[model samples]
Target chain A: MSELTPLNAIGEFALINRLQAGLTLRQPGSVLGIGDDAAIIRPTAGTELVMTTDLLVEGIHFDLSFCPLRHLGYKAVAVNVSDVAAMNALPTQLVVALSVGPRFTVEAVEELYAGLRLACEAYNVDLVGGDTTASRGGLTLAITVLGEAPTGKAVRRSGGKPTDLLCVSGDLGGAFLGLQVLEREKQAFMADPETQPELANYEYVVQRQLRPEARLDIVHELRELGVHPTSMIDVSDGLASEVLHLCAASGTGARVFSEFLPLANPTLEAAAEFNLDPITCALNGGEDYELLFTVPVTDHEKIKNHPDITILGHLTGKEEGTNLITKAGQPVPLKAQGWTSF
Target chain B: MSELTPLNAIGEFALINRLQAGLTLRQPGSVLGIGDDAAIIRPTAGTELVMTTDLLVEGIHFDLSFCPLRHLGYKAVAVNVSDVAAMNALPTQLVVALSVGPRFTVEAVEELYAGLRLACEAYNVDLVGGDTTASRGGLTLAITVLGEAPTGKAVRRSGGKPTDLLCVSGDLGGAFLGLQVLEREKQAFMADPETQPELANYEYVVQRQLRPEARLDIVHELRELGVHPTSMIDVSDGLASEVLHLCAASGTGARVFSEFLPLANPTLEAAAEFNLDPITCALNGGEDYELLFTVPVTDHEKIKNHPDITILGHLTGKEEGTNLITKAGQPVPLKAQGWTSF
Candidate 1:
């Protein structure tokens, strides 16, 4: 790293000028981007826009001790993009408002923005505009993402029907297990300054925690497969929680089978190492950033052999209630024990 | 306030449910609103959308000792709406992200949302979606406003040409003056706990600081009068700073007359009380949220007699430089002494 430039030395306007250097609007609808009072976007003639916002506050959402600024920045963008994917929309533009404490330097802020830029490129979204201000506490990021979907094509959380197959992309529980590993390492370091983290065996789980990617690929693939989800939501608050959300919004019930949960080898091993039940971890752990949706029973054939997706359950009549069927054939009510900032 | 219920007691989801109560989508284009992964908006035909974001951090952009949460919320929306108005658009929707410390009660958060809802109703904008989370510091607000404008009617900051008349809506400097009064009262109260603030005589200026409205009405009036501004910007960072921005963006220069600045009676009186030059305050004090623009000389006849509009000066060649012409006929180079969070 070069010598750090104090944020105040260059002032807000100069820092903004430096941050915006070499930036280009890649989205065709982005008529005007940064350096204006507001960004202008020419909406596609037959498209509806989806908007979402997420806030990440230091000491609440992430710890500076282990969470690198760059990865945090990427996660901030990916989370909002995940919401857009849940709506079956393709992200187009984003505006980030960042508040940094006095301890931050201009170079440090640049590194954060660099990660944001990388995610924007990966998601094919344009960095339209943003606000930068000073915070009395630690770093805070508020990101708002705008995505576009063809007229009447965006999915909603309230459109599910009885017997619809509830499916989820990728595996779950890895991110939460990964956080456990990181927490253990941090504790070891605090107990002895010379302690080093042994993460070689937990690489996959660690990556899931530190740099989760939005499951936008599934959205595109589903479109190509001609399988429109009846109801959809991102797995931001664990599978059990999101399943409940889908059921509540759709005014239906669900039956999730413990034996059918898609669990990665890494996540299973980490859960065993932590002496935690793999099924419980899969059901209640959060932050996987995977897409969860329900499709008509007839559409299941198209996605049955899809390697990255899993059929976890099916929607049922509202009177049936939401439950998880165990291997022993016992039905236990599902609960949402997802992460809560409060 | 009712019995102070702690934020954690209700949990994040319940808190969200409480906050979103009775929030109806008034905009015809708002297809979906809160309680979903993302909000959906169907853009009006042949219109472009404008977007902007602003962040307000406690102890940096505001002092809660003299600022109410409701007023702070209103100001946050107004500031972002001001940016949209600068683009000559009508605001359509808004998304707010709030982070509150443990000290904030559920009732307090409700108060803040009340103000936000009031602003949404006032602007005829929909409260689409938002994220609420815990903060380690005081309250922080990040607001993003979305507005709509006709296909090619949205104004930009780079259209000013030499000799275009510089125009501004309403008076300036009252917000800054109001802040000074508040700070003074806070100090006196700190020295003597029972000392009451002497704000009766400074009600107008005090209100300016506490709750400044965005000049969207002027944008509508300009359109109705058929006077299209060649270039426009909101007077957020004072008249001089915005003039410099217009000049820099348009590759022109400007000459502002000291005597032509519109000053409200309360602002003038407050300036005298603080022993600050009225011209200096109007040229440098920020947060007025008024519109600053330039129009072709031919359109001057349309707005010349408008009660709220004032013609300050005119654009000049780049070589002439941006200057404030004093009543004594001396040209003093303009400088941007706007607020800097750093």
Candidate 2:
């Protein structure tokens, strides 16, 4: 945000020291934080550790044209936090490995770390340790999040059973529409450098794409309500792909009701503007980062009235196969057409 | 090594499935390994967790011209493990995040995983979870390693006392010399496509460069010998840099005896061939992944006879400052000059 300083000017250790200077450990489990060969954490006596990693490469994962460095940094940590939430665990510590090309300035890196620090505080997770290195290509970030859940209480995608209610947290398809809006704006900007693309109407979708939050709240609320999910996963790859994942992992089939799929007003508006069906977008539009979990049918009433949750379907016998029940009573096979990395 | 198959042909999920199929959890702490949103681990009672991360960028940290994918994979994991060893911990689990460019094939990815698996077995650590994505440039790897040590037993870089004896594990400078040999061979190969590497005489150095091992054995031996290091760090950067880190962190100074620095015969030969000083290679030729530590002077006799360790020097009061006692008995201030990332 200020004067640009080449990374080479300060050197690696100096950069690390500068970035690590203001970090404070807030987690009780954090025995040591940063500045050592490794950070140390003392896990709670009866808790198990849930570890997940995500690698986000520039161009492939985000474009610098519309995606600010700060937002990219926040999203990187949030995505991994979402995975931890999917496990029904509370994130405790995180380590980041950042690789930056020469084009990046010290101030740019600080802004990215500022976003990371914000996420760390939001999640109440400690920034324990990390590696910072130079890259020959664009910026890349790899984050590994460590979380904890009561021993044997962490949910897995393979724990669902027949007759389990499939529930999803929050509305979907916003992130996908958000991407479409950004892409359109990017195209306009590219066509004319002086063009001031209008984006006021797309604020919600844009935020969904640029700064998606992890559904840790859903994990917390479920615990508070005395409801234990039979199986859980995050809607990172869309509702359809995640439901399929649950079914395959748990050896059960699911019937998702198309009409019951939650749609936010902004998402519907964006879908209409883009000439797309809101239901299809909700089903296959990925990067929502919402929690999708299955609870025993008996616990349905406990969470049914939750403001942010929607009961989308129920698990059935594996022989039934996974499908989406249309509003007209037709059964359509579900397919996983989520985002592909390669 | 087999018929090459493009990565996109099989898709991401299929690729993950293929890579994850044969993974078996060996660590008793591993409650779950792979396939879930996150891997789960149960730390042993009364032990603290040590975590560290490392990012390896293509072209910057390594050149694929002479570096095999498998060795690259192994080195990535080993380097993180080395950091764990630096904290006096036993590595238990690892997570990898890989970004590969379009030029890479699925089979090539398999080769990389094969190397990862080999390292996992060698280190007695479990390959628990990872993220794999396509890169827009050359391959990049980020690894996070988790290890455990008895409560309050894990060493830190800030624990050295003024009178502590500084020691190092194994011979140094070999890996640096190895890189030199490989780079020379790469140049020759590039100059004439028909050129053979003629690497018979430089096997040891070449291996050191391509596949450096972590010094976990030193950690175990120190434990068994009833000798605890006052301070410890991995010599990822050269000895000079690492010694300075110890001094700065411990609020003390150190005197490194150049004559006492251990250099293997092969390393010496390579240094001679390159017309470089063996001492300089040992001091500033990094990538050795050896352990640099300081132990209480009283415990020196216990480790002095150990085959792999060399007592390099002793810690000094802060006023003395860090310096290297040359072979000719002149004291010179030690400068890092280790490999710079930026």
Candidate 3:
């Protein structure tokens, strides 16, 4: 949307061109790219396609007050990539359906596309085709990411063994705490029109909210480590909630020590400053965008020495039930208080 | 939306569960459906897949004043299927990501799903996966449909020939006029709330808006008749605009007789009632969801007697340019003023 003069960034047809431009296909199977009634991609051989979709609403999933448009676009593609990643596959293409209110300028739309293009480059994805429409209300983005994995190789949440080690990549709760800090700062600004957000002390937490990266790098790293998780799900809804999904799908229980939870220094500091329980935030606050997977014990040694991976717990017998063990060895039931938009 | 009392629908989780429960996936490739991060489709034969996405925003693409939740859901699926149909492929699966506000309820979401499931059933498509989230504003729907065609056989809009006979299936502008009448009635109702809608006269046009069907049946029939369109595009954006696309993509021009443009009885009546030109509506107004294609003239004889197919004109050399020749033999320059939400 960068321009020298006053402009309406999202003049219906221009958005379609922006999305289709700069995307080059590597395969002949891409029968079509853009500017048509429908996009056509030849199905791959020896593999059935994996598909997933996500909708990100403006005021609900993000706020322009703190969340930059570029990062939001990146996160938008990243989360969809995470789904493809969670399927233990490599994403090859994407279709974006964008709806925006007239308030958005072409420059704003370009900024969003800049972030989206960045993700497409890093992930080696082609922006094939999509519909761009006007919204009567907010800016809404709906992305459908297409991925491919060898037939029968997609890791499902139901395949974990009772003895599998529960592991996570990167940290948890940063995005949640980041949201908290952003909300607090916005409130401060609203109370005093002249006041600016004072966020030097909470930079990391703020970054976590404004810009979140999916753990696709971990996906590649794990591929190099020669490990395929028996049961995998991303930390999208919150740790406890995702754990419940893995447990329910695998028909097992989880036992983890509270001390083993990973929390960044900034996250812990910000949580305490806000009078929040860091442990609870890590447990129930969502948007961590990390990888939560269960691997057979045999595969543990491969990742155990890795710096970013965290071995939080082990899959448990059903009779033991889904529980959280304290630092002092006490047991408590685990519950899923995931972020509910409705 | 059907519920007399909406207060009980506040908790969104229950509604999600209810919608998820009644639906079933019968696809052989579907390893899982609807309950996880993503659905896995074990593609057979590692074939080339066709993927397309369409976005529909409330107020822009639809009006709640006339479009029911059920028909909105049906139309959403239908339009996506129309894209797949344009490819001359068989639809196998779909993923729908939906955003709605609190005004919607458990039963309301179910009504929408019921309509979607009906389209899926009729079209032999499986509902593989989707994202359901809350919207801060009006409802938004993004549906991505996956289709399958034999390797090297998918049709595209860029393959038209200069001498190809331009053909169309069914009629046009019913949906457009349908929208016009709906908007008119909505205004009338705003002027006097005591009046019931005078909609019976516009029933067919209204149905075109409410329950537009994809031309998948025509796709099958074309195959049975041993016809492969030299070029094809769906008539979602109206006859003239689609003709322009077919010509532009093929580096050719099209000359169509406005006399040959098909119109449903209700569309003509509504146009007359509104003091509007039916031919203009058929030319520029969109959302028809019919098949518009160009077949080699050699193959036209084969389809000359086919009930649903109507030969309109022929593709011409680019030098001749795109034109709409009226019954009196006057050449009119064609401009594609398809519906623009912006």
Candidate 4:
């Protein structure tokens, strides 16, 4: 390890100076950035603003023993951005508030900011302003993202109508399986200090868990194809829970076909190794950061052949109830069973 | 104590349901509120958005021993709203994210939100969206405020000129003294649990510490009087510190007259009771949430005799340095002993 300065050594002002030195504003609406009582932005004319905030607690949301600081920072920003994309909006700015304990060094904070900057660069978003303070417990990250969409264009989870085709972006269960592998390796390392855990073969699943990407590309593609989703949500708390959210908000029921659920090969292999069912993981696993939406059946032609898109099922009347049709031709009531910290 | 529901008993979804039921939409721009992936708002045309975020950590920022949960919630929102007021903006919406430990009851969370809702209603700001989850340690609150100001009309800390008149609204040092009283009472209570704390004598100061109001009324008064501040900041970290911030940002210096400083009777009495200098408390104490600003010398006549406004001194060249002019005709360089979490 390199010699690094602890946060207290340089004090809060110096730390803020070091962090602000590398920021470059890329958003035209960002009239004024940091170094003020507040940030100033000019929302684009004729557009509406979309805002979302998410809090990630240390022990509850992640374990530092397995989660890298940089990846944790990236994931924090990505999850909030995912929420914006779920509204069919383009992310523009982010305000990140972080609290760290005494154990966190300035270099560790820099590594975390590096990941934040990387995400900003990838998503074309600007870091506007935030508050940084010392924590009494473990590290906590609270990120708020600002996005924009044309008036009347932003989607909502309550807009879905019966018979609308349900679709999902990317694959699921990879992140959950990835977490299982990391937990297993951590337990092994804890039990025997001399053991060197081999993880080369589990790279794909592990990376999914460490660094999930937001599906903003799908939002752009839908706009380009002139196909607007009637309703949308991000798959953060598992597909089953998110589907239930959509159903509850839209006052409709959903029929998700188990056969059409997307599952990557690495996820399946990892689930098997853990003696867990792959389908269950795909259905109930969380933190995939995928976009789930419903579009009119007539618009399916525009999205059907897309490589990253999968048609899960369609919306149904509220009387039908939300269910998952298994491959064995049995209907099971969809239970959320989302990851709950309480 | 009354019977209360544990957080786990009702679960996350049920808690959300209970909280959302009480929220009503007051902001016309709020196209979509909670129950969606993100909140949507349309800022009035040709207005710039002012954004600010603050994080308050348990044990670090406040002590639950004396700090009521409702007051903590109100203070969290007020502090951020104070930032918006410093920018000469009207607050419109807020996003509050909270993390609570398992020990917190559903009733406790509702008490916190009741305070939040009260603040929102008082400021006419909508509670648009947020995320709530479990924490490993104590309660944490992260609040982000969104406000609007006409383009090019928002005040900034860097707009002061050499001849600008330095001014502050309301009195100072009350909150700091209030905190001192609370700490002393808490120590006494800890020494003997049977002792009933007497707070009637310290009502004014105690209230200041528990519920500091954002000076939005001052922002409105300034606008109505046709006096646009050249530079502004909220007194969150002492008068001397905030003066230095304005000076550093504006590339100027300031001369504050100690005799002209505003000190409430309660603040002076409290400081004397602790055997601390009243002047020092007025200068170095924080969390007053008062507006400290500068205006052109030509506009002094318009604000000179305002009941709540005090003309502290005037800005000076950087070479002159920031100083506090004492009643004995002595000039002392101002020091920024602002609160530091680290």
Q: Per-candidate TM vs. native?
A: 0.99, 0.99, 0.95, 0.99
Index of the highest-lDDT prediction = 2
lDDT of 1 at B260: 94
Sorting all predicted structures by lDDT, with the top scorer first, yields 2, 1, 4, 3
Best by DockQ: 2
The 0-to-1 C-alpha lDDT of every candidate, in the order given, reads 0.93, 0.94, 0.83, 0.92
Candidate 1 lDDT score at position B312: 94
Q: Model 3 Cα displacement at A42 (Å)?
A: 2.8
lDDT of 4 by residue, A24-119 (tens): 999999999988999999999989999999999999999999898889888888999999999999999889888999999999998888888888
Q: lDDT by residue for model 2 over B1-342, one digit each (tens)?
A: 457899999999999988987678999999999999999999999899999999989999899889999999899989999999999999999999999999999999999999999999999999999999998999999999999999999999999999899999999999999999998988999999999998999999899889999999999999999998999999988999999999999999999999999999999998999999999999999999999999999997899899999999999999999999987889999999998989
- Candidate 2 lDDT for residue B43: 95
Q: After superposition, which runs of candidate 3 have C-alpha atoms over 4 Å from their true positions?
A: A1-10, A26-29, A193-196, B1-12
| Residue B45 displacement (Å), model 1 | 0.4
For residues A1-342, write the lDDT of model 2, one tens digit per residue. 457899999999999999997789999999899899999999998899999999999989999889999999899999999999999999999999999999998889999999999999999999999999999989999999999999999999999999999999999999999999999998999999898977899999999999999988988899999999999999998889999999999999999999999999999999999999999888899999999999999997898899999999899999999999999989899999899989
* Candidate 1 residue pairs in clash (backbone atoms < 3 Å): none
- The positional error of residue A340 in candidate 4, measured at the CA in angstroms, is 1.0
Off by over 4 Å in 4: none
Q: Model 3 lDDT vs. the true structure?
A: 0.83
DockQ by candidate, in order? 0.94, 0.94, 0.67, 0.90
